[model samples]
Target chain A: MARTLINLPKTAKAGAVIEIKTLISHPMETGYRPGPEGRLVPRDIITEFVCRFEGEEVFRAELFPATSANPYLTFTTLAERSGTFTFTWTGDNGFSQTESAALTVT
Target chain B: MRRALLGLLLLAVPAAAEIAPGERRSGFDQMTPELRAMQTDEAANPGQLWVGDGEEAWAAAPPTGRPACAGCHGAVATMRGVAARYPAWDEAAARPVDLQGRINLCRTRHQGADPLPFESRPLLALTAAVAAQSRGLPVAPPADPRLDPARAEGERLFTRRTGQLDLACAQCHDALWGRRLGASTIPQGHPNGYPLYRLEWQDLGSLQRRLRNCLTGMRAEPYPFGAPEYLALELHLMRRAQGLAIEAPAVRP
Candidate 1:
């Protein structure tokens, strides 16, 4: 399983825009690069990333081959209530990982 | 008579000025603001991914069915400050072994597993994790008589010119540090931040890999990985960086 890191404030004021950051380890190999014996390396990349709060989608991104290895994303979302934020990353080679964090709204 | 005296004074000057202890700077201080931010933020630092893997490996049993690291050593947190004094003398091997070597020794002697290949993900991951425990601690090379000869050899290697460039490491790192080389600023080549993530490589690498990169850049044949020369150089570097805080799993551009 690929390792991932998620960062967000444990508590935030209601209606505040809380920032969230994430990073995951993946080679994100581009198809154009040549491997041993001059053959092209096959493309493999995280196809999509989704962040949801309390089962409601908050943000989503569509990744491409050009994306760098170990994809990192940072975005802000309004904190309305206390709940868990779930993150899902789906990629080539049937790679998928899910993680969650709790945020309390004051 | 005045001209002769001036010539004598000029000849007396050393070839290169050694960097004073207080004047030394870690590669972290030389990084750009953006890169510095990347290094400080755990969520943004890609090196943490390896640390995570390392945490798992530290506890998981290998195919040998032997006890895991935690089974003997307990939680990895107890390993704090251990990495700072690496490349230490190994009584069994009758030589100096760096932190990576020590880990591999444990694998072979205690865990009954084959040594992990150099620069492999598993090795880098475990090394990074162990070194991360020493973060913020000062680099304090052990005060052992046996290490002196190796450290001297390392110093000699650092000063001796080599490769097609015929330039010693001191030329750029000690004397010309703070000067621009191409688009990059030449920072004092310190070893505090190691097993770090470099933007150029897009992956974490060991100090040996980096040293080999420099050797290749100089058009010289690099010693094989885990070579004695590389280990000696690492020993000298750790001593040179004494009192500097450890920044393992650091980020660089």
Candidate 2:
């Protein structure tokens, strides 16, 4: 499986804002480059990345070939309730990966 | 006459030309300071993702397998010196095999499981993980008289001109080492930090993937995965990387 990494605060106060970071290993092949035979390399890149906090959508991104490989994203979200934060990355070539982390609001 | 003379000169030089100890350096030495900074930091380096996954895979049996790798290997720490000694002669296969190939062999033969596809994420992850244990250890491929032929074949492949570009691996990597190839610096073509993270690739990949990329860059035909040529090339490259510290799960641009 493509490796995914996430950073989340272990503890946060209710109603306080928290930062989240995510990175995944992927080639994000742009399809523009030529192969050994001068044929165009097929374009394959992460097309969408979404993050949900406590089952509510908090951050999302539409990725493209221009996006760097191993897409890294940082965003802020409110620690409304102690719950699960689920992140999903969808891309070309049937590539889809999901990761989750727990946040405790004290 | 000139072409023959050039060939003669090339033949006079050993393909496995040794760099003096004082002068030998890994490709990482040629990177810009900023990239070096990123590669050196575990938190910033993306190769950690695969390393992490590799940690997970080590403990868990494949979906169908009865034995996990940890069943016999004990602790991951025991594997520290293991990766540095691979691309060794596999008596059963009667050929040289790298860490990845060895892992697949164990999976299929010992684990009673299907082998992961070459360049697949699971394979790359596991390879990175195994290699990570050897981080900072010097590479020391075992010396065996039986492997001499494979090593020689690898040297020939390294020095042979290929593709429309008609370039040999020695030209850009050896002759142009530390020089600029457009925006990027040419590396000495070491195989230490394989299953490495390439910013251009945006994903972790095997040494074979990188080799294929180079072939594409040269506008040359790439051999199929698991081909003897790649194994031979890997054998040759690992020797070239001798004495360099293992830095698997390394980051590259």
Candidate 3:
């Protein structure tokens, strides 16, 4: 899995709408079958992913098998008095990631 | 005034090559007969092994809780042209739906089959078998007023850019298609051949899957499977390559 890339507005009004972008590099295999040797590849997938502002969850998602590998999401959020925004990914592999960026509200 | 008008026209003119600018393609000139042959071989053989496995799964698993698709369709060859005609204008749904969506509907409503994941091999093989039926025929979507919205949506989605790279579909396929993107070349990335076998992927992939791949390549937040915007793009791409040959299970270098 490749590291995710996130792009958020460097600066925004204290209370303005901004689009947040996130992309992760994951093969996202929906382990429904075996790839080689007929052994089940095992069902491992990213089941939950979320974004938070200062420890407060802002956006959350429950992924299914239909979701593509390397999931990408675009969303809007109110820039409520900038602070540290954290993004996290939780997958079936028990693999999780947490990355954060500073947002300055002016 | 005429001279100035001509100048403006010249300024407006595009000097791009066959593909959109900033994109890379080996170009028709560089396409080797050998490479084309390899791809042709894959297409010719088709993924019979996988489809055969799917047929067995369909028979044993009983997704529909009815009988196997083999029992109803007998042989998939009889169901040819079904895929090419869908996201068909379903009278019941009143919309265009792709094979996966249709399969889901059938599994839930008709057969009680399980809805496989988007990239699942079973789903891929089943859809491939169905689409394979239309292997030789040109994709001809029905003409209806309802398709207007989808067409426009597709066009818009095709051109809109939303990513750190900030490049739209046109930027690559239309603007800098023939240009270099690092080491590899970019093809026009036409949708004529999908559920294609890409050397990079080493397996069959759908049109929707390709669109998601492009979004990732562009570093944009990609939409979900069966997303309206992406579906529109697929519809538009299929429409764009209307007369092109359907090259499924094709191998790309």
State which candidate has the highest TM-score.
Answer: 1
Candidate 1, which segments miss by more than 4 Å at Cα? B1-16
The CAPRI-style docking tier of model 1 reads high
CAPRI quality band, candidate 3: incorrect
Give candidate 2's root-mean-square deviation (CA, Å).
Answer: 6.7
On residues B169-221, what C-alpha lDDT tens digit does candidate 2 reach at each position? 98887777878889888888899898898877767889898999999999998
Q: Residues B173-251, candidate 3, lDDT per residue (tens digit)?
A: 7766556789766667666555665646646677788888889988998899878776677677666555555655454
Q: For candidate 1, lDDT tens digit of each residue in B167-217?
A: 899889989999999999998999997899998899999999999998998
DockQ of 2: 0.39
Task: Give lDDT tens digits, candidate 2, residues A48-105.
Answer: 9999877789999999888887777889988878899999999998988889999998
Query: Cα lDDT of model 1 overall?
Result: 0.92
For every candidate, C-alpha RMSD to the true structure in Å: 4.3, 6.7, 21.0
Candidate 2: CAPRI quality band: acceptable
Better structure of 2 and 3 per lDDT: 2
Give, for candidate 3 chain B, the lowest lDDT window spanning 10 residues. B20-29
- List candidate 3 segments past 4 Å from native: A1-106, B1-31, B42-46, B55-64
DockQ of 3: 0.01
Indicate the residue-level lDDT of A64 in model 3. 84
User: Tens digit of lDDT per residue, candidate 1, span A1-106?
Assistant: 7888899999999999999999988899988999998999988889999999999999999999989999999999999999999999998889899999999999
